[model samples]
Target: MTGSFGATSTTDEVLAGVDLSGKRILVTGVSAGLGVETARVLAAHGAQVVGAARDLAKAKGATEEVRAQAKNGGGLELVELDLASLKSVRACADALVAAGKPFDIVIANAGVMATPFGKTADGFETQFGTNHLGHFVLVNRIASLMKPGSRLVNLSSSGHRFSDVDLEDPNFDHTPYAEFIAYGRSKTANVLFAVEFDRRHKARGVRATAVHPGGIQTELGRYMTPEVLQGLVDSINANQPAGAQFSWKTIPQGAATSVWAGVVAEADLVGAHFCEDCHVAEIVEGVDIRAGVRSYALDPERAKALWAKSEAMVGERF
Candidate 1:
């Protein structure tokens, strides 16, 4: 089934009658925005939700909000996770494993966008390190703790259209570090990660998907300079003609697709697809279009190579 919702669809609307009692969901970056909304809706639906954030205080606040929204209340728990560090990722997974309960869905929603050029604690580029490699290790570390039929959702972006993975200089070693290109590479890796992940784990009943949550105005862009933000505003306005005041998605609306992918029963519809607006996206090409996964993002060989490189970097293998 090709289930389709729109950019305007809210989380509650998409999950209207779905019952998730007894299900367990792990959501990363649940401190605010779409991630918080996602945790709220899932917990409200009776899922045992774990809200993972880098800051314990933020996680506590977000969990309280989710609990207040939950019908049964206290269905949410908080965990500390800093995806920029592989050691932290492993530690978080260890804590979850210590809990001895398998996660039914793992949502890799936390990410850094176009931040200033920098290195992660492990010396990898910031965007690539946190957005892709960090999640890469986290998922693999926790893979054994995932029950059969569990789902993994990686939040990619339309920004992926700007560039593909730069295998030669993923860390910007020899090339100048352009923020947008770095972000694009990371987002592209998000898609490719899901592709390779599904290939490896689908037969074992663990499925993976990548999502482009459209252009929601969120804290993800907090690192952008005023000029950069204004340029983005101008570009959106010029292309959309709909008053370009970040007229893309509300947080709840943006979280709808991720929620759907987590709960939707149709396995065929969920895995290895680049989703947008709650449906499988149509393939796109060239510079002018605004739909579908770019071919490079889904290249299987590239995905495998990325997976191998990631395992080496993280010092772990799935």
Candidate 2:
């Protein structure tokens, strides 16, 4: 089914007939998993892909397979980026800016899952800090590097169905912390980011879209313990409709939507929607292990509010 593409698409299948010569793309977290795969297919199609990760050495080692996939002048290079820290985000943005090349597509793919309650370098919750705020700052700083018709793809998750952002206590200062909730809130922030980003920049020719790349098992879940994994399984099982099948995606299957969003002209043109598989997801009324985007995630007012709060937190305006 994934081979046939469409709602069940894989990375290469969508790019199979496309040409990306002269295109420049950026993918975060390319050290492994979906990020590597997303880069691989794009490069294979003849795009120049710059992959950013925290550990350049690890990324260099992990992207070997990705390099092997390059064809048609598609090439991959590693850049140092650690989204958990604001300083690192700035440095990476600075490096990219100095390179003086605007990206045609930006995939904010690197992220963390539910972990033991902890804070990032700037004292924000681990999941919220890295998954949302970090990307928020980086994208803002790098906005100037996106020319008109640029595509910005943020890797959101079906987990956004799990909860909405708690604006008052995103950092867990005023409210009690729950790892899963933190993850959900961060994912929600991802969708909201696209909403506001596209709203703000679409007129300038930059388009932004968010994708829930399905439930693929990846390094994004490294922090989930056996107990946590089982709990996730149980929660999913309980919430899903009767007889709904549970399927974990292969890496290729997981990256289909992000790649599709980046290269497909129609998708880039119709931006600011959260997608699953390779199509715009329907607005779901309530969460029950369904695959549609949440109302709160797409709420315009909430998106604006989150954008303002993010600017305030990051101490910079885009």
Candidate 3:
């Protein structure tokens, strides 16, 4: 179950010839960038895509854009979801479940990156709350509605290289908070989440995977200073001495791996694998970040522990 696709691949390219006529797909953070492109391509392939976002206006606008690009019109729908609030997640999940629609694919593609220290309405750290816990609860709440062969894709990032999950202080309760560290911890949780989720749910015919969409200039980087952004460019250049200094995929390219995981038949076979550039990435070592999954990111014990803790924190069980 190799998951590799090329860097130049787009959503349409990955979805080519795949007909999703009766499938229903839910993509969070679909208001912009890779999320929008993912929804557009899925809808084009005949999946009834619900573009979930915090803002109804933005969701509607993004849905329209996706609708315009859809070969089969009316395949896109707008749904409200605010990951920053667990209450909102509950409400949205309830609404969807009440509608009696079972989602065949769920791509947890929405997240905040490197934002200033803050907390969700539930008093959890913003990044961990919105990026990890919110999706955790949402998936658990909706797990009952998922029929056999359904898939859930958690959007992780190479930033998992930055840090592992901090069990002692996930909410930064006892330590000084750093934005990048918080973001990294959250992303690492994203990977472990999929790993443990697959462990628990795959036996029931559901599968979960995590993906690192290669760095693209998107709203996800809205909080970074120009110096920080340029510093990343400089670092990439310096690290890849044998290659181009900076390599970035377009939003469509960045979204390809996720879209592929959502619809590709081979995806189920590669459950719990961390993917990047549309493939099961090789594990890397020695702090050189260009290659593989970090040791900390794939710890099965850690994944299970985190899952238990998350269930405790959210007060729910799947």
Candidate 4:
């Protein structure tokens, strides 16, 4: 399945002719953008989708359209989740565990981007808390529900190339806060989470992987200013030939790789890898390689370390 698809692939295209009847999927951040599209397309293919959002009312209203899109035994439902708060994460996981329905796929698709400095209710840096530790606690709490042959897709970002997790200072406690760096570390944490989780759970027949959905125009960029955006573009293209255009993918294109990861039964994809354009991404060799996994993000030792630290922070060990 290597490079079978590219940035232009649509969610519908990756899933065309695939039957997901009897499959139940859990998708976070399903209120808008890629998450909504992911749920809709999977449901369209006959998967029962349980979408999680911070606001149940908003989720209920938004998922109405997703429910309408369901066909052939496909359906959509809602669950309340606030990833910025540990209590909310536990409640969401508890509710799902109580339901006793195991998911065929769980997509950790919700996340915040480079927002200004702030702390989550848990007193951790906002991005690291919501994007990484939040899912960390939620997943560990409900891991029993992810049975053998299940997939967990964590939505990472190409921004992971920007930096590695500062384990000792993950909350920017003693260091000056930089929004992009925090975001980068969190995204890196996403990849490492999948890595260690897969290593630990593979024998149980469970697998995990992280995905880079490519650049897209979405609310995820709500905190991004023009100056920041231009700086990123300049940094990414710094070594490339002049006049080469930087591009953004459409929403469907952004969701394609995730949908692919959720359903593809390839054993080759069972390990932790940074995926992009529907395939495992290779590191671009240079001073400014922005399209693939950084070595630090995939280090098994670091992954294990992060897991331990996260468990300590959340006061639970899984």
Candidate 4: regions farther than 4 A off: 1-3, 241-244, 284-287
Candidate 2 lDDT over residue span 1-318, tens digit each: 223345567887887888998999999999989998998889889999999999999999989977897888889988999999999999999989998898999999999988789998998898999999999998988899999888899999988987899888888888888877888999999999999999999999898989988878888888888797877777778877777656678899999989887777374544888988888888886767567888999998999999999988888888
lDDT of 2 at 143: 92
Q: How does candidate 4 score on lDDT?
A: 0.88
Measured on C-alpha atoms, candidate 1 has an lDDT of: 0.85
lDDT of 1 at 28: 95
lDDT, candidates in the order shown: 0.85, 0.87, 0.85, 0.88
Candidate 1 lDDT, 10-42, residue by residue in tens: 899888887788888999999888889999999
Write one digit per residue (lDDT tens) for candidate 3, span 220-263: 99999999998877776677757545577998899998977777
RMSD of each predicted structure: 2.1, 2.1, 1.7, 1.7
Residues 21-65, model 4: lDDT tens digits: 999999999888898889999999999999999988877776776
* TM, every model: 0.94, 0.95, 0.95, 0.95
Worst 10 residues of 3 by lDDT: 283-292
User: Which residue pairs come into collision in candidate 2?
Assistant: 149-205
Stretches of candidate 1 off by over 4 Å are 1-4, 72-74, 236-246
